[model samples]
Target: MLDIYEFSAVFPSGTEIYSQNVQHTIRSNRRTLGGSLFFDKLLAQLHVKSVSESRPPSANRGYLYPPSKDGNLEELHDKIVSAEIADHYKQSLLYYLLKDCTALDDEEAAETFAKKSHLSHKYWIVIQGLWNLDHLQFEAALEYLTHPSLLPAFPEDILRVLIDHGKLANKHLPLAYYNAVRPPLTNPDLQKSYVTYLAHLSLIQAYFFIETQPVQDHKSLFELLIDDALQHSRSDGSSNVVDELINLPLTAEQEAWFEEYLLEGKGRTYHAARDTVVARRLALGKYAEAIEAGQQLSGRRFNDINWDGIKDMVATSLGSRVEVDSVFNVAEI
Candidate 1:
């Protein structure tokens, strides 16, 4: 059990020696001295951080015997879907089993088993949504998530799976983005979930991967107009989309928006939002705004991009607004 692992963590340098010591102490004639209790408390203090692992039903999976690993997983799955046998803890067992199925890429069996609990079994419904999402069954996942009964218990998991699905997907980014990330931010029914911040992150991801229109003044400008574009500008990982966006002249609306966003950073938090607003300010030739935003960041965020070099560049461009007309070569910064 976890208590045993606690022992190993504390005595990692001499695990065998620690085990033998505990054993000898237990067997010694010192039982009157409370040696076992002392050793137990000593090891108990060394609790290792644990992530709970769901174990499968080893026997009696259903009306029939459980099959071997892959095939048995499918067989238990079949019984889990059977209405007559699905009444008790069978559904719960199926939820745990499906994780293994997903790990094994047993998509056909997992998907087919998942559909049986669509309208009922909120637990299985979430499990199925995760399984379907893993298999890239976006439509099924959206449909699976629509049950209303399934949202409250694990909204964060559902939200993350949807966002991840959209991230890896190519063709359905727009629909997947809307289906997965948008509702958690807007839906009154889900107003209590604390994942609104993650939804903001996902919203910008949608813009990068899918949302677009015919090139306007610049393709980067059009991309920047996607609402959440500024939310995660650092996400593009060397694409320079953020820099390209900064290089454009800020519209009255954009400047106002950047001002508003930077103001929301109470201090040293909302790092991504602060960085994007600073990048925009640097390009808009607003050295004051750049200096204020840069100063508000935590050391971690300030170091995210070289703020010293950037400060010098912005200071250099103060009166000139040089980057608006040229490439804004602040990559060194």
Candidate 2:
């Protein structure tokens, strides 16, 4: 039977010396189970004592098990004696241990430990944090994303990180994330916001790719836009045709057709067609043209179209909305 009193007495200096001695003993007698148990128990006691000294006075004030209570100390002592500190302090300690355990570099070891730790909720947090954008450990990210405990948090940050790092093109990343997290992402508002953000990013990417990339045929670009719109429509319950039209990329021919076939027609309805034309113009880096076209369209619908803003954004690359005007003239007119 381990004496808890004796263990508590060796705090300030005995702890370090005990650790060194334990390490030496473990090396010398690798096969001694009794020795291993004794060393682990002593080390656990030392750890509990250290934590006790450093803990804030306010901590555990309202908890059922207050740190300084005799009963809590006895519980710690019992855990140490049983060589089961791993079970008792697993969640709190594992979080610290896994902080630098790289998902890519230390994946196997980390995953093995995660399985053995028997603390799935805390383990999920560790895995998700490691897979975030700052880490960009794709292999690790995918591995953790597959974990049953880490589904929703996995897609949200990981996809955004990939997009920000340019590892995934704008069109694919959002859809991928949306798909990955959909089963778990139950909030309609969050779903709508994420889809809208993705749509915006896809439109920005399409504009840049079309203007600078010397596209031989418009098929891929059109497909990307249509797909993005479709995804948004699916996620948000919006009409697919409206979304497609609003996201279309207009060429000179399409612009001319809009003027003759749509805008000049007797029953001209400017809102939907104009929104699509403006969106296309914005996507083409044709700011002045966008502004002019936007102004010709009727209703307060074009009011939301920022023509001066778009004009200032002409020379900039896609997604760079640096332009600001006193007000959107199209909206006023």
- For every candidate in turn, the CA RMSD to the true structure comes to 17.4, 17.0
lDDT of 2: 0.42
Scored by CA lDDT, what does every candidate get?
0.41, 0.42
TM-score, per-candidate, Cα-based: 0.30, 0.31
Q: Across residues 119-224, which tens digit of lDDT does each residue of candidate 1 receive?
A: 2467666555544554455667666666666554334444444444444444354344445544433332222121233234444442343223222322333323
- Any residue pairs clashing in model 2, and if so which? 303-331
| lDDT (Cα, tens digit) per residue for candidate 2, span 136-174 | 344445444545455354344344444444234334544
Give candidate 1's TM-score.
Answer: 0.30
- Model 1 clashing residue pairs (backbone): 67-72
